[model samples]
Target: MFFSSDHPKHEFEESQQCKSRDAICYLCKNKVSLVEDESNAFYCCQGCGSNFHKDCLTVTYPKCHEHTLTFIRRKIPFPCDVCGQEFPDEMYGCLQCDFFVNRHCIYLPRVIKITRHSHRLSHVLRISDGDNVCGICRSLVDVGYGGYSCIDKTCNYVAHFHCIIRFNVWDGKDVEGEEVAASEADDVAPLLLVEDIDGESTWRHFSHDHDLLRVVEEQESEELCQACILPTYKTGKFLRCKECDFALHETCACLPRKMAHGLHVHPVTLHVETGDGFFICSVCNQYSCGLMSYKCNQKDCGFKMDVRCASFVEPFNHTALPHDPFYLGVDFNEYIYRCYGCRQRSRFTARCVQGSIDFDFKCLNLPGLIKYKCDDHPLTLYYDHRGHNSGWCEICEEIIEKGRIIYTCRHCFTTLHVDCILGKYPYLKCGHKIKVNGFEVEIASNNGASRPICQTCHRICQDKHVFNGKDQVCFCSVECIPSQACS
Candidate 1:
């Protein structure tokens, strides 16, 4: 007991790398350094040693292993220490207790301040009876990923972590983040410093009749005014009134834009207050707005119109009628009358009566009906009606056919149908010349007598004969007269 005796030593084989008497680590093949609990040896530093740290070993395993062991021991399963849930196999455990914790979960921040929300949010472990509903949008967060509620006990202002952070709930503005401008704010135009204002005027084109003007200060007016026309109380943003009531929709104030109209294939440009008093709009038949009229600027061409009316397409169809649509034409006459076909009075000036007839002939295919005779049979014009049809022969009979039928001779009152006399060429052999609108005609023959025979038909005229001085002209019927011959 009084003397300190040297510890008993053990000898190692020469092939072994151990310099001292000690056990070697099985994993690294290094010599064990120190003894633990009188039996277990420290095989390496605590990190690499077979002997685990108290906390680390207690978390991984329920009980500690015996000292001086060579093999690593298996860890036990337990609830997660951080999340209070069943721990995964890969989680670190404690040897002293049943607690186990995930590495990432241990370092997760407990409280986060988000820029989207108005209040700080804290990590919530679980829902409880004390927790209130979310303050924003009044919804309940019953389960995972909830945030810390407000300090008031009765106030159930719990918000989800996603609701607060994802939506940036701390931001003072609304979700759209639009900024509101101050009321009655003044907006000033930017000032340009010029070397010489006079030099700039030289380059400007003098297409407009008005003098060059510059803007002074912003004016507040609800009326949409034009530079050449008076102002009116119309809701529009464009309001410029320096020259005259010349206000334009901020859109129409700018000119020379290319546009298409129904009247022309080529694009046209805006023309403002340039034409003389006699200017006529191709459409609408009205005087166009001085500031908003559109015209085909082509030289020597007469097309011009208001921008609104020029947009109407040609051959326009209306639900009211089956005939071809007509547009109003400009006529400067004083008296106004309704068109026979359209039944509408002229807007600015009276339309010509000739326009009605011209429209019928050109648009309605009516002239063709007047020029061509009926296709069913050949008929000669006659005032007298004596045949089977309704027409009358002036010399003898009472009635004739409506279409084509026999008529009396002008000189002898002899009745014959087209088939009875001419055989085939009734149109050519007819002695009378046809005329438009049913005017009377005279037939003549070479020999003078009370009645004369037609040279072409070789028939004596039953109707009265007129002398043309060169020959004794005899009329069988007015229908036998040729239109050219009568003319």
Candidate 2:
């Protein structure tokens, strides 16, 4: 009695009226049998001059076509027109048009913008026959199915429907009708070239106040770059400030003034404010002095990251985890995920593409060999301590857990916890004055006659360094630095 058994109607006159009309059901593509007298079930849209089943109005997908698609509950194998894949399940379809869409493809947005590309991509039903490569995964795209393609005719960029929608790549925003906002030139470029002499360039980077000269020759001095806190001379090429001792590695100097990262959906700006004091990176969760950081200025969203963690891009490869190239996993700041390297929870991690392995930012960038005061020889970062259960950390005196990443001196047989060796604020230089929450604070050594009680937490300052405020209040770690004015 109903238009279709799947679509049940309450009144008999409505079903009779549909049977009487010659107009086809725009949704299921079924013609009304011209025999009945009464009519009330059909819903006519005056604007579009289209007739629809009463139930079909809700399931209408304008992206597919102007006509509605009827919901069907059959398990027959059918190739979905959107994804071009055969699924044995219930779906929405037009029987006459031979068009079907699975549940997953039914709700896909018409347009999306991803961090992988500059242009907004439009969902297309098919690509002109050719061998197309996905820009994100570096794999061949099947042209037979629907996918996302660059809207600009001049650009030939195309990507698989699945590859572009990964959480790491896309922010899941539908920008179908939105106009692209043009950005200022200064926002993307990092430096301005002042002059060039004998293939060397003099430039003024946005992060610094003075002009910098590019130096190519390797030097022996151990001056740390103001940007990354790494040795400037060891990096081979660097930009040295002419007016001051400030220096930056060439790569660090050229970081974008503003950029979008996978960790955050919003754009972040690079800041080189030394007065901001130490900030724990949102991605790596490591304490770093705010000498250079990418900070999100969104109100109430205090997202900040160090340059080292900000520099990581997709398809990340590491020497330690050489089995497969990794992709940015979920930004674990709001969730908990474990890292394989240190066996500790991390705020963010890079997941192996082929397997279930993840590495946090700190463990991902650990130095293989480092000098420790207890051992004359350089301590080596050991992956597994299965063979030797060398009791406790030499510094913290805590039981060294099995399978944890530790620095060990093979000769001296001394094992130390990674945190115990690097301390909490490894990137923050000692003897430097910085402003923490508008309070002038000095990074000072804690190895005095007795450790001072932290003003904020009232705990003994146990770390290698203590932050002394202008009021002579002591704080244990950067985490204890109060965001408000001291009493």
Candidate 3:
């Protein structure tokens, strides 16, 4: 019953006697948005008037025995019902039966769909007969509590509860709430505007300083397109710099001028030249790939984006994550928030609030195998080590903080500093000479100067990586090789 009148015994626990208008959540214990909202604050047993966040009701076991299981807020170690192992933190317990469940073990779905397999999987009681490796995390699945297993016994697919709902696999849907739009508007803005909509074909791109001339006839060349870094198509209508050899596929030239990605509240504006040769994309953690990108224009904010990330308008979809659709938002929540993907603080993140989940752009942009030259095989982010960011970087040899996300390869025992492996200026083949405008430049290491800066971004490079060109030391990458004529 919602109120005390339904239960004849008017008995109430101390917590239930008075509902504070500033009632804190019994589970997360954090101040909820309900502190001020007029809508239903949380789940309350009318008899006691005790309040609870609705999330605490459904994400948790709905019922224990015949009654609703109460959430234990205090941190106490107790044995679990499913695995009989030590359960920590918020546990679901039954006062009458003396039963308790690990917070993670409750609300375990019976059957579910995951991107790992084509078929639906059911919760298996145990996998005792043979070797059982979780299909998602690729670790040994603990049979004590069982796990979501493939329906077909011949196909051996088992995954831990936490491994199944990775941002990459499940669609971020709030299973409890009614289906609704994630944003106020669903329509997408026009990507780019043509110079002459009357079909003149010449285009003025937002990122480029020069107007791109369209190729009308077959004029094939061995030159590669500047945007995709691929060979120019011989038969396709592409755009080329009127003077320089820089070119782009027709489709690549029309990227959106501005977009609201799921990571930040401000719109990311497209830029042809990031103006920083040494700046790495925080999302992909790679060099700018000599392509147009979107950047957060807010002062003191360093957020930048690749063409791929800028294209995914709000309500960005993955192979689809089944909790809540992540959207672009700023963290004004009045509390610290750590990202679920990179396991870093939400300094710059894409998020789904239903689970209080935040993902780094690297995860939200694409949530699957990451290809890096440092490792032979693809490296993937593991949720097991998500919150434990303790280690030392192999490249820079700096101590990685306990809360930083360190991507690892279980097979080769290869753990890497995300930045070192996917660095922006680290890919240059040192000593290689290239021409920019009219001047020749050579790739050189930063000689540890007291004050060195990139000519483009004007940010102090601190003698990091540099391009020696006629007295001007360019610390940015060759993508924007600095030159007097080009200046």
Candidate 4:
């Protein structure tokens, strides 16, 4: 199957490579089945003597230079010239020059369609100009190199190569020759882009009476998203009730309605609001407010799922490692065990417990890279904290626990405790600015300098939580807002 005009005027030959149990494909960077699957045949290029899958032989792509890259076994680790991503597996490369490319880089669709945006996104080779931020990961993208961008020039939407294809946003279909379904359930009515009487895009959510208007611009007053409990920053688009002040980010609005949820036997219905007062989530054991949550409708099922739990894409695959998928398992006061991730012994934590294995949501959701205003360079998450002198945390000054996963700045030798950086309650994102008290107050660390006291309540801002935005900033909890404080 390996054929190329560029290889030789006199046809170059390929000899059949033996059927092995496992062989890595140079193009896709995935191990191919050799024994079980009869189609796992490979051929060696007489021109190159490099082993290649029959499937990978044909993905010959031409790079910026005139070099034509063909699939071949990688003797040395190579970085793709197109995407700048490194790969250890065999890849399409010119045997002569330094030019190399992965299958994804070679055949990456020129245009893609995703659920997050309405317009078709084209694979841009370069940013051309301006700060084009990725809509999904919230990180700055490389403008020098190209990425997925909205087809519409006026639109500012852009996405990094990996961020756009995350399990949260994409359903893993390439935009080539396939019609991308809006969602897994297209039969259900689409609640996202509906319009109200004012000609603004509005949504009729199962929760509220009035249609929720999509607010693009930040209002003079600050608004907290009912779902995530974070301020509706002007930068992010949010849906607000035209009748009332209820608002939530678009990501929260698109949360699925029904899930087996793995933790509960009965299917949980996404409840907009419960007439019942002050329901605590069965898994995280946190109190819920007015935001929509996945609540068990079954009799005596007191299980409630908060928006963060509900928003996690189901069948939580652990592709980062070769392990069984983690289901959202709940203890329900049954099992009290130490978490393998934090090594903390707690009666209960926000954990994803599999049989004989336990990992807290903080461990699962911990970003690979952490940014601290306290330090210049971002700290990378290090799993093995052994042999290093139990360094003191820069924030709390507590000894960094040994054998626990911690964030560390290798350059400066600074280490941080898991909770000191993430928080005791990691689900509630701390330190991000949201509106409180008419000033932009930081969600300072509980262990950091001085904790802010609520001007009205006179109690310390417990957990060192802070939310700030346009009009107001709050040091204490959302309950300690103008409604309670002003009263």
Candidate 5:
């Protein structure tokens, strides 16, 4: 089926000279045949090779050298223009374009504009002198594909796509704040503008909620913010003007969006205008204008919040414990007796009341409770020392079962609550093997060590009995019970 330049009718033979056997000519099957003519010919079949004149083969495949007839293969590796990653050899590439891009970079969208700028910017293949530099850092962008640049010839501002989209901007005047009546007002407010840092033309405007926004100007002055009372800066998101710096962080500007207090079962909803006077959040004990707080919108429940405390998420980040955090929900029940984790009386601690009923208190210890094999028992539920006996439980500072006669395996001394032991625990110390009543149990020394360690907790075990003929059976404590047994 294959043909060569000199012997058109001969069957093809593997070439020892060719280094790449996997690479075949696109048109022919028997490694591409090389011809001595100026135009080298690559033959696929004998019929085609004999039909094509020597001149035709020369036109298709040209020889580089003059004296010898040699076949040469060329492989090309091109680098991506966008991310700079290289493409594979012999990969399809663009010949006419200088910007060599891999397949991944080829799909990138041609244009994108961010909200931080007023005028729309387009993606350009090459840098120009008139392009705007970054508004924030004032830097030139050379390689980023997803970015925005100024279009004006005079401006040279550009910004990373992510930076422009993630930032929140605010004008000094229109942010949320308390407004005093004309009789109590001391001075007039100043005009404030929120403009894109790159160019001066674009500005942000507030269409709704006007009363909370105000502006004031002063000369070299610093004051506690009328809002949060945190120090204010002249040009930052939260500012007190030099004329009369009355500042608030942009986050603080929108206060009391939602809140729930410990004192009441119902959650309070706060708005910018309806709050009465200054109040404090019952949860965190921070003061606020009491505006925009979550209060029992109910008439009979007289609970309230300051903006600062009302916005806190319940189950918010707790440093002392390792459990999933949660926020206090609305509809709290005040009658709950004690904290779930600490067991302290609920009246003293902030009890999260829900639906007028106190639910279980939050704690980190409750989630890991399960069946485990103990040093003393075949299978048992793992009980925290704190929950077994109140005294022991208190000393251990844990909550599963402090000081009670909990169920445990007699052989391993593994303790568990009756419910956890009967409902969950089964099988060997490792707990990996299912226990058949007739299944054989074996006891052996873990290696030659006098005291073998439990695989689960990695603690030394005085008992060296491994179950189900497993290589190792020692258990340090009840917590190391494995869920399944290896065969």
Candidate 6:
């Protein structure tokens, strides 16, 4: 219900001039009662015979307009002018103007903060023309409809009205009138520049204790990056610690201290601490040892995502699979499907909406090219062994399945299993210490005089790596890490 404010005094004067019986209320499009007293009706315009029920003229939506907006009844469904969503229910609008709003969207938050972006989004009647992709769902956002867009004009971020309001996306707060909090001082830099002598900059990364020297030269060494646990051979530029053996890929070193991910509603902070041992990423379900993770900020939530999974964004286009660009489904967790890449059933996957193809994160993020021990040249990842007969893996000595992803050398045509090349814990670096089932375990090389016997699998550790405990108990892979502590 709206009270007549001083601002609409001219409208009230117009209502008083056209006090006529048997006239239609322009606000509600309903007949003014002839039996009712003159005080019950209000005239809208003198000569137009446009009158309004005093009850209809009393209600106003201040956010949408200054004039009175009243309930409108319609038998057919109509698209809301604000959200552009079609609905069959009655709506509220100003009869004089074409502005009609859904009842549910009447009090939409003017300003909101979502987990997938850094900037606050503002509710607007219309975004720009052309293809407007939603930042969350990676679907087309209608430019004619109302949606949330970045407050910064320079940033072209936009989200659908339905996608932005989901429980997993929005925090459900309207911060329009509240005081904006100051930017976090710690978020300014991923690494602090300590000294710049003769164009060589020594920096202190937040993940490391000592100062680091940027090495632009590509390294051929097999040493793994402490941040991502990936070998250094392929990493072009990296930052090596001046004091100790800690090092990080230049890309990994520049990761922001805090970010919002689509996996959870709250912002996640970068965690470099290695005390918790191996953490299984909630998204990829892969074990990561000595690699940094992005953990949810909520106190009770146990959401932790690996760096690889955290880096993935909507509408991902793999260079190898360019024709099938995949986008994360908004309700991916609610359903499971067989993956096209690995044939494993998983809910955490991105889909090629056009092709109806799903690829799990594990198979989706496989390195395109990697060096194998037996092959002199780098092996290229193959989605399917097309144009070639299915062969056995040279490393695993197992028949390479037709549908499964594999790595093959074009020069030698040597085929290898994806797991045989990447191993069970591909992200886990050799020689790093991790905790498993309350036991301190070390990732050890399995290339000894005799392969170690895996305690969990009761077989010889066939993989290139093994997890060893202080008691000499061995595990072939991260999946074989015993639930009970080693005696």
Each candidate structure's TM-score, on Cα atoms with residue i matched to residue i, is 0.21, 0.73, 0.36, 0.42, 0.24, 0.75
lDDT values for all models = 0.35, 0.71, 0.55, 0.57, 0.36, 0.73
> At residue 94, what lDDT does model 2 achieve?
73
Top candidate, metric TM-score: 6
lDDT winner, 4 or 6: 6
Model 6, residue 170: distance off in Å is 2.2
Q: How far is candidate 6 from the true structure (C-alpha RMSD, Å)?
A: 9.7
Provide the clashing-pair count of each candidate structure.
70, 2, 21, 14, 61, 2
Model 4 agreement with the true structure over 1-487: per-residue lDDT tens digits: 4454344521323333544445565445577555534476655455554455566665444433356566544446655665556665545667677666665666666677664565667876676566665655445777766678887888888887756543234434456455644332333432545555667566776666678877786553446677766557643687888777777788777776765443443456777654432345665555444357777756776877777656555346442222445543334444455666676553333323333455555465555566676888878776552334557888888886655677888788788876677654444444443333343444444555776566546677656455443244434655555542453
Candidate 1 lDDT over 262-310, as tens digits, reads 2342345655544331233553343222445666655766666554444
Query: Per-candidate RMSD vs. true structure?
Result: 36.3, 7.7, 13.8, 17.1, 25.8, 9.7
TM-score of 1: 0.21
Could you tell me the TM-score of candidate 6?
0.75
TM-score rank, highest first?
Answer: 6, 2, 4, 3, 5, 1
Q: Which candidate would rank higher by lDDT, 1 or 3? A: 3
Q: Lowest summed lDDT over 10 consecutive residues: which window, candidate 4?
A: 181-190
CA shift of 3, model 2, Å: 4.0
Name the weakest run of 10 consecutive residues (lDDT summed) in model 2: 4-13
Q: Give the local distance difference test score of model 1.
A: 0.35
For candidate 4, give the lDDT of residue 429: 40
Cα-lDDT of candidate 4:
0.57
Q: What is candidate 2's lDDT per residue for 1-487, written digit by digit as tens? A: 2233233431123443343346766555666444433342554433334455555434677777556676654445767777666755346777768777765676688898765566778999887666586766556777877888888778887877766655456767788888764321236578789998898788998777899998865655657778777667646788889999888888888888777676676667888765555667877777666478998856677888889888887777765455577776654235477777678887677777666677888886676667787678878877552334657898988898766677888898898988888776778777777666666678988879998999989989888889987568898876677765554
